[model samples]
Target: MTKTFTENDVLKYFYNEVSKLEKEKIEDFLSCNNALTEFYCELLTTEELLEGKLEKPTEKTIQNILDYSNTLCLQN
Candidate 1:
């Protein structure tokens, strides 16, 4: 049986979450379909941008989390 792929499947392909067979099928499908290929490209660009923009929480944010945990522990 032939399986049809969706955007979700393409995202799985992007993250290497799909099985080897599914990955091969998705790549073949993307090669044939311009629109789906474009969507996949967009996902790639968005992922790269997100990776580039990653940042750790501020010290204040970490302290706030610890303070909240302490309050919860006191209440317990």
Candidate 2:
């Protein structure tokens, strides 16, 4: 029989906040449930993005702001 996980179980899984055994259970649920898999995937993506490891803006955009600042320097 398949074990059912609760929302808290899923949340803990997403945050890597659960014990190894619980994580294993979450993995089992994710493997068998499409909705859970998608939820897990989105949660992982959000966590990664929050960790500054995803969707970083381009370096050129940063450089452009610096360049614009240089153009605004006060004339002596």
Candidate 3:
């Protein structure tokens, strides 16, 4: 038996981890469910914003890891 998509599927869908059939079901449900449609729209908007908002690591952090690795290699 196939499982129908529910509001909970929204999170998996947003993460692009839903199966193709499940995605189709989710789309179908969103088309007819007004509350779900609004929620889906908001989720899509948030995903878009998050995609381009990655934070860069500081140079000191990178140097610290490299220094630690060098010390471990010397001890070994």
Candidate 4:
């Protein structure tokens, strides 16, 4: 029987969480489906944009976390 893929399966493929055989199946599935391929492309673009926009927490936030941890340690 032929397999049908869902958006969830595509996400699994995107994250490389699928098995090798499943990855091949999804690649074939995407090749035949324009809409799904477009969706996957959009996901890729979004991931790129998100990666570019990602930032580390500010020093103040880091300090606050350290201070809180110190307080917790003192209480124990």
lDDT of 2 by residue, 28-72 (tens): 888888887777788888878788755777999999998888888
lDDT of each: 0.91, 0.82, 0.84, 0.95
TM-score of 3: 0.60
Q: Each model's RMSD to truth, in Å?
A: 3.8, 8.1, 3.2, 3.1
How many clashing residue pairs are found in candidate 1? 0
- Model 4: residues with Cα > 4 Å off, grouped in runs: 57-76
Which pairs clash (backbone N, Cα, C closer than 3 Å) in model 2?
none
- 3 or 4: which has the higher lDDT? 4
TM-score against native, each model: 0.68, 0.56, 0.60, 0.70
**Regions more than 4 Å wrong, model 1:** 57-76
> TM-score winner among the candidates?
4
Better of 1 and 3 by TM-score: 1
lDDT for predicted candidate 2 compared with the true structure: 0.82
Instruction: Report the number of backbone clashes for model 3.
Output: 0
What does candidate 3's lDDT look like per residue over 1-76, in tens digits?
5455666787788778888987888877778789878888898898899989999999999999999999999999
